[model samples]
Structures are given as C-alpha cells and as structure tokens.
Target: MDFGEFVMARTPALLRFAYLLTGDSHLAEDLIQEALVRVHRRWSSIEYQGGPEPYVRKAILNQYLSWRRRRSSAELVLAELPERRDPALGAEQIVERDEMWSLLATLPRAQRAVVVLRYYEDLADQDIALLLDCSPATVRVHAFKALKRLRAALTPTAVAGASHGRA
Candidate 1:
C-alpha cells in the first residue's frame, strides 16, 4: 500500500498505542508525528520489509523511550498542585479507568510496555519479545511482575483479608 493509504488505515490504531505507552494524548500525537516522519522517509525500505505498521510502531516506541529518558534526566519543580477532578465527571467506569492508568504509570517503562503490548495490543509473549528485542522469558518476567504489582495495588483489601485469615 501507498504511504497515504497506510497512514489513513493505521493512524488511529497507532495513536491509541502511543497514548497507552505515554499516558498522554498530546505526547502521543507528538510521538506519532515523529515516528511517521521517520517512517515516511524510509517508506520504500519499510514497505520492502512487507509491512510498515510494525516499523512505525517500533519507531514510536523508540521515540517514547528516548523522550522519557531525556525527560527524566531534567528536574523540574512544580509551584502548585493541579486542579481537582470535576464531580460531574464522576462516572464509575471513568474513575476505574483513571485508577488503572495511575497504577500502570507506577510501573517501570519496560514493565509498562510489556503490559500494554501483552494485554492492550493482545500480542503474544514471543511477539512482544521480538518487538522489544528481548527473550520470551524476559517478556514473561516483566508481564508477571507488572501483573503482580497491579493485583497488589488494585486489591489491597483482598490481600489484607487473606493475611487476616492466615493469622
């Protein structure tokens, strides 16, 4: 497919993946723009590899990883706290989603990427390993650690209850 056709077909999915990786819509847009630019420049070569989507995704992931590394290296101080959430926006599902995202944000980058790829992208461990340039065991370990952390954070009451029962 042509570059434009590929972009039209893939942009939405790419944006969603980027957003999941970055947890920010604006950052996701920036990531997609940077990735697409690189992909466009190498479109012929990427297409020769049989598909551009994976190549674009890898570019986006690399860009995100690089951007995050740079961002973390710079220290910034906030003068004040941000505003509170709107009470009118108190849908249970939205709150749950926000909580989940907040929990996911606590994970290390590789673990977060592994979780997003395995669950959100529904990719197999082997595929994620290939994409991340790691072994399948490494991917599994990341996923295992991420899920363990999520479970502990999400269900502290259950864990507490189990501890009480054991006592």
Candidate 2:
C-alpha cells in the first residue's frame, strides 16, 4: 500500500503502541510525528525493503529509545488520564488497570519498554532484545525485574499495608 493508505490504516495502532511505550499521550504523539516524518523521507526504500508496518514500528521504538527522549523523561500522572471508561470492562478491572499503569510508571524505562513489548505487543524476548539493542538475556532480566515489581505492588498485603501507612 501507499504511504497515505498505510498511515491511515496503522496510525491508531501505532499511537497505542507509542502511548504504552511513553505512558503519555502528548509524548506518544510527538514520537509518532517524528517517526513518521523520517519514514516519509525513506518511504521509497522502506516500502521496497520490507513492509512499512514493521519498519515504522521499529522507527517509533528507536525514537522512544533515543537519548533525547530519555533526557527529560517524566511520569505521566494518574490525574492526566482521561475519565472515560469502557463499558466492556467492569469497575474492578478498570481499577486494576489503573493500578497497573501506576505501578508500570514506577519502572525504569528499559524495563517498562520490555514489559510493554513482551506483554502488550506479545513479542518474543529475542525480538525485544533486538529492538532494545541488547541481548536476549538482558531482555529477560528486564522483564523479570519489571514483573517482580508489578507483582510486589499488586500483592494484597502490600496494597493494604501501604494504605494503612498513609495516615
């Protein structure tokens, strides 16, 4: 497909991927914009070399991994998330999702990216390692550490104990 068609079809998914990577809507938009601009310039070669989806996705991931993106990184606060709710998800599930997002925000960027790529995108460790420019063992370590933190945060005793310590 042509560039425009490819963009129209993939932008939503791309946006979601970026949002998960950056955890901020505005940053995600900026990532997509920058990635697409570079892709547009190389469209002729990319379209012929391989499918644009994977190429564009790798561009977005690389953009996210770049030093500039990490230079002034900030957490996307829970207050910044929209108030809308999905009808298909129960209230408990929604709360769980919010808690998960908050917990995920606490992770290191590389670990968070590994979690999103492995679970959200369902990519293998080797694929994630290639994307992150690390070894598969490194990717697994990130995933292991991330999941460990998530589990610790999600444990009932931890949550209950945390709340009790608040006041």
Candidate 3:
C-alpha cells in the first residue's frame, strides 16, 4: 500500500487512541485530524526518519497538554458517555475498565499520559519518557503511582462484589 493508504488505514486506530486519551470523541476526532494534517505536511521529512507514528503520537499529546494549559476546562465533558458493554468480557473486566478510566481521568495530566502510553499504547517506559520529555525512571514512577491509585480505587468494588456474590 502507498503512504496515503497506510495513513487512512491507521487513522481509526489513531483516533481511538486520541479518544481514549482525551475522553471526548469530538475533540479526539479534531485532534486526530489536526495531527494527521501536520504529519501529512511533513510526511517526506518524517518518512525517512523511521516510524512516524511516534512523532504523531507525541504531537497529539503535546497539543492536548498545551490546550489543557490554555483552556479553562481541560477535562473532557464525558458525563454523557455510556460505558461500552462487551458480552465477551466478564462483569469484572467491564467494571474494572470503567473504574480505571474514571480514575485515570482524575489523575494529573502527566500521570494520565504515562498510564495511557504505557498501557493503552503499550509503549515502553523509554518511549513514554521520550514522548513526555521525561526520564524513563520518571515514567516508571508516574506509571507506578497511577497503577497504585487504580488498584486502590478498584479493590473495594471487587471485594464487595465477591462478598455479594457469595451471599
């Protein structure tokens, strides 16, 4: 496939990643469009430099963070977004993902980026550090803290559900 085809094929995944990052579908679409436009404008410049997805990813994150810094409402208005239900997923996984995403939204910008990059994007610590312009150790620490918070938030719910199931 050619460059445009490759980009078209990957745009949905990129938009989904942005959606997960921002939790706003509209903003996610806009961000993806903007990121792709920038990438397209510099495609030749990026094509020779290896995979450009990382560059696009970094640009999206940086743009989001910058917008957050300048805007009054950095948080996405996701109150109306209903959780996606999957029949294949057991109740626990469904609840866990939702709860985890909720807690993730509550985290500070940098911590949220770390968690999203590490888990959602499955990027290595070094990759996340590079994207965030931080050290690998700092990425590890931020990921550690985010996971700790998620664990704390989810554990009680799990325990209560287990107890209720047994009753």
Candidate 4:
C-alpha cells in the first residue's frame, strides 16, 4: 500500500494510543498530526524499518515532552487533562474511567507510557522495550509498578469491573 493508505489505516489506532498517552483528545490529535507529518516527510526511510508505528509513536511521545517543556508550570496541570468521556457511558462508568486515568497520570512518564503501550495497546513487552528504547526487564519493572499504582487506586466496584471484563 501507499503512504496515504498506510497512514489512513493506522490513524484510529494511533489516535487512541495517543489519547491514552497524553489524555487530552485535542492535544492527542495535534500530537498525532504533527508526528504524521514528520513520518510522511520521511516515509521512504521509515517504510523499510519493519514497523513505522513505533517510530511514529516515539515521535508523538517526544512531541508531548516538548510540549510539556514549553508549557508553564501553571499549564502543566491542565495540559494533562484526562481523556475525553464518551456520552454513551453512564455517569458511574465515566467517573470510574476518569479515576483510572487520573491514577495512570500520577505515574512517572516512563511507567505510564509503558502501561498504556502494553495494556491498552496490547503490545508485547519486548515491543514496548524497543519502542521505549529500554530493555525488556525495564519494561517489566515499569509495568509492574504501574499496575501496583492502578490497583491501589481501584475501589471494590472498579476491581469487580476488571473481573467482569469491563475495564
């Protein structure tokens, strides 16, 4: 397939992953857009890399980091807003998701990125290790710590949600 086709096919997944990483839908969109532009510019080079997705993902992460660095301390709190809510879900479900995201946000950047990439993106630990340019053992450590923090934040009902396959 061509570059446009590849990008079109991957955009939704990239957006979801970006949203999970940055938490704000609009900012995620902006991040993805900028990253995609850069990817498109280097498409010939990236197309031979086996998995351009990781390159794009790393670009998005770097974009977020740059954004954070440029932001004032006062803006940091707001810039890290939770993912946008779905109007379809019930209030309780919405609140639960928000709480979960909030807890995820509390993690150190590397840990949070690993958790989202592993659990939400369903990537193998080795893939995440490659994406983050870390060892598989380090990815495991980050995932472990992130899960611990999430588990600590969960209420009984939220824990039950996981058992019910709702989380």
lDDT of each: 0.80, 0.81, 0.73, 0.74
Clashes of each: 0, 0, 0, 0
Clashes in candidate 4: how many? 0
| C-alpha TM-scores of all predictions | 0.77, 0.77, 0.71, 0.72
When 1 and 3 are scored with TM-score, the better candidate is 1
Candidate 2 — what's its lDDT? 0.81
Tell me how candidate 3 scores on lDDT: 0.73
lDDT string for model 1 (17-53, tens) is: 9889988876666777777777888787654455777
Model 2 lDDT tens row, 47-139: 444566877888998888773753335432232233346799989998988888889889988898999999999999998887788999999
**Model 2 RMSD in angstroms:** 7.0
Q: What is the lDDT of candidate 4?
A: 0.74
Candidate 4 Cα errors over 4 Å, as ranges: 47-51, 65-88, 155-167
Pairs in steric clash, model 4: none
Clashing pairs in 1: none
Model 1 regions more than 4 Å off: 47-50, 68-90, 157-167
Lowest summed lDDT across 10 adjacent residues in model 2 is found at: 74-83
